[model samples]
Target: MNTADMKSRHTGGSLRTGLPSTAFMLAATAYFLLPLWWLAVAASKSAGDLTTTPSLWFSDVHLAQNLQELWTRDDHIYVRWLLNSLLYAGGGAALGTLLAAMTGYALAKYDFPGRQAAFSVILASVLVPVTALTLPVFLMMSQLDLTDTYLAVLLPSLVSPFGVYLARIYSEASVPDELLEAARLDGAGEFRIFLTVSIRLIMPGLITIFLFQFAGIWNNFFLPLIMLSDQKLYPVTLGLNLWNSQVIHDPVLRTTVITGSAVSILPLVIAFLLLQRHWRSGLAAGSLKG
Candidate 1:
């Protein structure tokens, strides 16, 4: 059969009306993009223009000035918040990924006593809501004199039960037992085998774990909110919330808050786009192996 005829037959000779699919796709696009579009418009307007102008389009084109105000206003605390977010998220994600990878590799490739029990505990911890632990964590930090310190936030952020789970699954699929056995026969230590073989094979899964943890730590608010009393220690999420709350009294801050919100989303977008290739490859490899 001809290709066109076969396709038609496979489709049951239905009328070629793609209108529903097209409309659904357009609706989905608008649903996601409309808020972003409004934010762009809102960010560009000054105090008066925001109220006077239409929300979907540009008015005074004062986004540059608004960004300047965001930086210079309020003791330039916005800049400090941005830096603190980067430090907390970046450092936490990196350390968390490393520890998760090591733990997962050991769990997957090694035979030891209490291994299953240890993994069961880690998995159980994953089921516990972080919000449930916040008060307890804060109390412990207070007793240890760690509250209000950077360690209070970064230390807890480093633990990722989900990341370890993903790493274990990926390690089992990607790193074959024969390879480790051969490496051992060649006089390579367990750490050397993990470093040289297992790590390279599991790179995609590691990237996925890093992205998840990065987004989590970057957008974390509750931990920082309760653990930190000083404004200097607040992450961007908490700082922006503070700015948003005061908008009721000083409505002029509305513009500044919108501008900060717009700027804060850029790092996350860039990070995801940069690592998206690895993420796709990792998920694809996992699914295919399964």
Candidate 2:
């Protein structure tokens, strides 16, 4: 074919490929964002206005009023619930990431007795339904007098088999064996090598693991419902459920529910923005291999 015809064919192929992918991306973005946009709009409306006004457009813009009402209600219990959620998600993610990273690193870098068995068990745990395990966990906590305590909910949130799996995959792919050997030649301890080299290389994957665990713990309901009876210890999910159930008697609470729901999602959004930078990092790991 002539050069001009060849260029024309290539242009056509690029257009055909890029157009569908771009359209799909736009559609997926809208699919995820539409509900959040509605929540923000609905939260701005009054109780009566929420139902009467358009679903995706602002009505009274009473967001500040709604926040104040939500705060002042029942001696600022909503604030307590928000704090509880932060603690559960943040603490769980931090602890879970560290443990998962270490376990995964060990599995990837070392060959020990029962190593395969350990990974197999962790993979099996990922397949098990978290809801199904909630009852047994609750029973165990009850026997240990841990039920209705912060530890009951927080402890379970700290264990994430999926995080371990992801960690192992990232560790093996990103942290070269040669780098570890180089560090060992310099007399760096195993823990020190992991801290300085492997961890730095696999940070993006660790951020992913942390985000997964954080979202899981933040949105977790069944485990908290089964484990906790104390309202003071309730995370945002359970606390919001209590508020939602109360809407039958006090109608004004509808706005609070919507507003609180909108507010509750802000932390996750902020966390994603903060952690997204790490996702682009560690591309230089292979280049730095000794």
Candidate 3:
């Protein structure tokens, strides 16, 4: 074939091959976004209007009414639940990420005895599902008289084995021994070296760990269900689940639940958006090293 014809044929073949992948991605995006779109539309409607209106389109906008009701219902219990969720997710994730960074740094950099054994234990813990541990954790918390308290939720969330594993891998790659040695030669303490050199290098990994733990704690249900009996102590997830249960009897709560769900997702979305840069950078660093 002539060069012009050959080039044209090759371009056409490439376009044909790319089209399916492009279409598939678009379809998948739509599928995932469909629920959120529905929730946004539903949140804008009253309980009566929800069934009557089109699922994806707004009608008789009652978003302000919903917010007022959401706040006034049970004397602003939803607000309390939101605060509880923030405390559990935010505080727990912060502490957990720090612990993970320290533990991972130790595991990666230190040549202590039983290092391999300790890591093996962490790996085993990671393999054990959170659901499996819920009962034991509840029993332990009961013995400690911690059940139904914020600590019951926060304490358990502060130890993420997977976060530790990821941090260790990232620390091993991102933090250099030479830097530690130089810091030590300059009379820096181990903690100082870590804070100044290693920690800065692993900031992206720490942010990833924080975001992961935050989302996990925010969405956690079973553990809190088993631990907390006090309605006031409940996070947004558990509170919403309770609302969902009551919706069968009280149809008006259906709209409240939907609105609450829509509202609950906003903080998580904002969190991801804020921290996504760090997450992306961390993944890139991991890939480059790997």
Candidate 4:
């Protein structure tokens, strides 16, 4: 065959090979997006329209009315839930990321006694299921008399072994030993060096860690379900579940629940949009070395 003919054949074969993978990707996308689309459509519907009208499409836009009901119901309890979720996720992620970075930096940079052992323990801890530790954690909280308080949830949320692992890998990949040595020679304290130099270098990784922890804490249902009894202290997930449970008796709450679920997703979407650039860079850098 002529050169052009040969090239065309190769291109045809490549396209054929990519078809299945492309199909799989499209299927996966639809699988995930369909639920979100349904939620948006459902939330926009009035209670009567929700059951009577088509599910995947919109009818009358009752979103504003539903949202107003959600906000004003029970003296505006949904707003409290939103604030509580923000506090739990935002504060927990930030503090957890900081602790993870410090621990990871020490592991990557310092050659301390039992460093390997400590890292091994952390790795092992990551493999332990969160569900497996729930009872023990509850007991610990009981011992400290912290259950039903914000601390009960916040304390556990602040520890992320996966975050530490990611931080250590990113530290090793991004932060140079020579940079640390140079900073030390210039008389910068260790903590100061970490704050000024190391933090900037590994920021993308920290963002990744923060995002992961934030999502985990935000979606956390069991922790708050077990820890909190007071409705005022409940996170959005627990609060929504409470509303859902009462939906059978109070049919009006059905619309409120759907609307609240739709609203609950907004914070996470906003967070991802805000940090996605840094988070993508972090993933790329971390994957390059580890």
Per-candidate TM-scores read: 0.92, 0.90, 0.97, 0.98
Tell me model 2's lDDT, rounded to 2 decimals: 0.89
- Model 4 worst lDDT window (10 residues): 280-289
Candidate 3 per-residue C-alpha lDDT over 1-290 given as tens digits, one digit per residue, 9 for 90 to 100: 89999999999999999999999999999999999999999999999998887889988899999988898899899999999999999999999999999999999999999999999999899989999999999999999999989899999999999989988998899888998898899999999988888999999888888989999999999999999999999999999999999988999999999999999999999999998889899878877765
Highest lDDT: give the candidate number. 4
All predictions: root-mean-square deviation over Cα? 2.2, 3.1, 1.1, 0.8
TM-score of model 3 (CA atoms): 0.97
Best model per TM-score: 4
For candidate 2, the C-alpha RMSD (Å) to the true structure equals 3.1
* Higher-scoring candidate on lDDT, 3 or 4: 4
Lowest lDDT 10-mer window, candidate 2? 281-290
lDDT of each: 0.92, 0.89, 0.93, 0.95
Give the runs in model 2 whose Cα sits over 4 Å from its true position.
1-21, 280-290
Q: Which pairs in model 2 have colliding backbones?
A: none
For candidate 1, the 10 contiguous residues with the lowest summed lDDT are 10-19
Query: Backbone clashes in each candidate structure, one number apiece?
Result: 0, 0, 0, 0
TM-score result, candidate 1: 0.92
Writing each residue's lDDT as its tens digit, candidate 2 over 1-290 gives 89999999999999999999999999999999999999989888888898887888876778888989999999999999999999999999999999999998999889999999999999999999999899888888988999989999999888989888878888888889999999999999999999999999888888878888888889999988988888999998899999999999999998899899999999998998887777445323423421
